[model samples]
Target: MSSSGRPPARTRARVVRRMQRAVPALTKTTMARMQAEMDWFEELDAEQRSFVSMVLQAGYSQFIEWYDDARDRETARATPPLSAAVFGTAPQSLTGSITLQQTVQMIRLSIEVAESELAAVVDPDHAAGVQAEILRYGRELAFATADVYAHAAEMRGAWDARLEALVVDSIMRGEADENIRTRASALGWHGTGDVAVIVGPAPSDGSSPEAVVDQVRHAARAAGLEALGAVQGDRLAVVVGGVSDPDKAGAVLAPHFDHGPVVVGPLVDDLLRAHHSAAEAVAGLHAAAGWPTVADTVTSDDLLAERALDGDPAARRTLAETVCAPLNAAGPDLMLTLTSYLDQGGSIEATARVLFVHPNTVRYRLKRVMDVTGLAPADARQAFTLRVAVVLGRLASNQR
Candidate 1:
C-alpha cells in the first residue's frame, strides 16, 4: 500500500519481479554463485531467502518500476504525477542494450546522465516532479554561473587597474634601502641571493588573469625563488628572490610567459636595492631601447645612463642651456651656415652652396664659433661635441 493507502497489487508484483531480475546484474552473479561466494547465503534457511527476496523486491523491483514509468511518462509528454519525488520514473530499459533504436535511446540517456550528474542534480522519482526539479536546478545553476563569470570579469578589470600601480610601488620600494630592507627581511631575502623583478602584460587575449598569476607563481616555485605578483590595468608585476644573477632569472622566466612581452628589472643584493635597481632598469629599457609598449627582460646595468639621463627634464634643460650657450648666441644664419659647413665635411664650397651663401662667409662664421666654443671643426671628437652642443642649445632655448 502507498501512503494514500491500499495495496496496488499489480504495481507491487511488477516491482517484485523487476527486483528479482535486477539482482544478478547488481550482484554480478547468479543465486548459486552468490551462495558459493558468501557462506551466509549458503546457510540461509528458505524463510530467510524468501524474506530477503521480498525485501529486495520491494526496494529494487517496485522502486525501479515506479521510477521507470515516471521517467517514461516524462519523456513522452508533459504530466504532473511524474514530477513528484516519490514517483520519479527511470527509463524502461537498461541504457546499453543492442539494437538501432536502443542505441539511439542509449545515447540520449547518456546525455541525460551527464546533464543530471555533472551539470545539475535530478531526482529519480515521479517524472513530473523530477522534471520540475530539473528546471529549478537548471535555473539555479544558470544564475550561479552567470554570477561567477560576472565576478571573475570584475576581478579582471580591477586586476588590470591595480597591476601597474603595484609594480611601480614594488620597483620604487626596491630602490629605497628602508623599504627594500624591511620587505626583504620579512621575505627572508639575503646575501648572494639574487632578486629580479618582472613586468608583463596581463593576458587580455582571452586568458584569465588569475590563471596567469598562478602560472607566474608556479614559475617562481620551479625556479626556487620567492615570488610576488600584482595586476594593474593590463599589466602584471612579479618580483622574485633566490637568484642573484639577473640574466639567469630572465632565461628561466622567458618560457613561462607564452603570450605577451615581459620586461625584466635588474638584480640587486638586498630587497631595498633590488627595488630601485629594477625600476631604473625597466625605465632605461623603455626610454633608451625604445621598448615596445610591451617588453620583457631588462636589467639596471643595461640602462643606468639612460635612466639617469631621464631623471629630471628641468635638470636636463639646465645642463643643455649651459653647454650650448655659446652656439646659440651666434646669429641664426651663422649657426645654420656653420652646421651645414660642418655637415659638409668642413668643405667651404659645399657649405656655401647648401646655405646659398659664399664659402668665405661660412669660413668667417666657423672661425668665430671656434674662437667662442674652442671646438675644432676639423677634429671628429670636437665635431661630435659641437653637434651635440648645438642640438642641446636648440632644445634648451625651445627654438625647435
Candidate 2:
C-alpha cells in the first residue's frame, strides 16, 4: 500500500518478530523429522550430519533474513535466496553425499514444520497469508538447492575429465606407474581383465568434445567394455578395459572417430602393461598414411608391414622372427624357392627356372615355406609382408 511496498511498520515488525521467534523451534523440529524420515540423513556419518545441521540452521535463518522489509509479492519474488550462503558454506563433499532430491525433501519438510510452528504465533485471520509467504520462501530455497548441486556436478565432471586425460597420457607415454594406477582406480578402472588402446582422429561432427567422449564411454559400456578417453589435440586415444577381443572393442568404438584409420593395439593382460599396447597403437597411427586403402578399423598387426617400413623395431622384429627366421630354418631349399618366386613376379615356372627345379618342386617348396613361416607368399598383402620380413631379416643378419 506504501511506496516502500511494505505493510505498515507496526504490523510488519510484529509479524517479523513472530517468525523470528518460531525459527529455532521450527529448525529443531525439522531436524528431528529429517532424522526419523530420511534414511539417507540418518545414514550420514557424523561430519556430514553436522554439515547438514549447519545447512538446516542457515536455511531457516536465511529464509527469515532473506525477506526485505517488504510485504508485496514482487519483493518476495525479487529476493535472493540462500543458495550459496546455506549450501556453499558447507563442505563441497556434502553436495555429493546429499542428493538434490533429498535436498528437496528437506526443504519441503522444513517448510511444513515452519508452517505449523508459526501457526500458533500469528493471529488466526493472518495465518493463511503467513503460510503462503512461507511456502514461496521455501520454493525459492529449492531453486537455490538446484543451482548449488548443478554447479557441484559441473565442477566434478571437469575434475573427472582432467584425471582421465592424465591416465590416458601416462599410459601412452609409457609411464603407468603407481601414481597413474591409483588415479586410474579412482576413475573406476578394474585391473582384472584384458586391456587395449585405440588411437584415431578426434571426431569433428560439430559435437562438443565432452559429448563425444561421453558417447564413447556409453558405447563401450553398452558393449560390456570399460573405456577411458581423452581428446589430445586432433587425436582421440581411448584405453579400453575388460576387452576379450581387442578388435571387437575397436569395432564398437570406431564410429566415434573421424577422417583417419582407427588402430587397435594388442590386448595385454593388465593395465600396467597397457603401455605396450598404447605404444603400438601410436606407432601404427603415425604410419597409417603408408597404407592408402587400409580399413577404417585396423589392428596394429594389420599395419605391421607399414610399421616395419616406417622403422619400428618392434614391428621389424615381429616380422623377421615370426616369418623370415622360420623360413630360413626350414633349410636353404625352401628359402631359395620362396625368394625366387617373389623376385620373379610370383610365377611358378619363372621361379623353378631361376632355381633350376621343376615347377611342382617350386610349388612344394613354397608350401613348405608357408608351413615354416605361417604366411602364404601368394596373397597380395601376405606377399608384401613376407617380402618386407625377408628384407628386414637379411639386414638384421648382415649387421650381425
Best by the lDDT measure? 2
Most accurate candidate by TM-score: 2
Total clashing pairs in model 2: 0
Q: Write down the lDDT that model 2 would get.
A: 0.84
Q: Candidate 2: lDDT of 220?
A: 92
Q: 304-330 in candidate 1: lDDT tens per residue?
A: 334435663432443355435656666
Q: Give the clash count for each candidate.
A: 43, 0
> Model 2, range 40-77, lDDT digits (tens) per residue?
88789989877877887787766666553334434445
Residue pairs with colliding backbones in model 2 are: none
**What TM-score, over all chains together, does every model reach?**
0.34, 0.90
**Alpha-carbon RMSD, candidate 2:** 2.8
Q: Residue 370: error of model 2 in Å? A: 3.3
- Cα lDDT of all candidates, in order? 0.51, 0.84
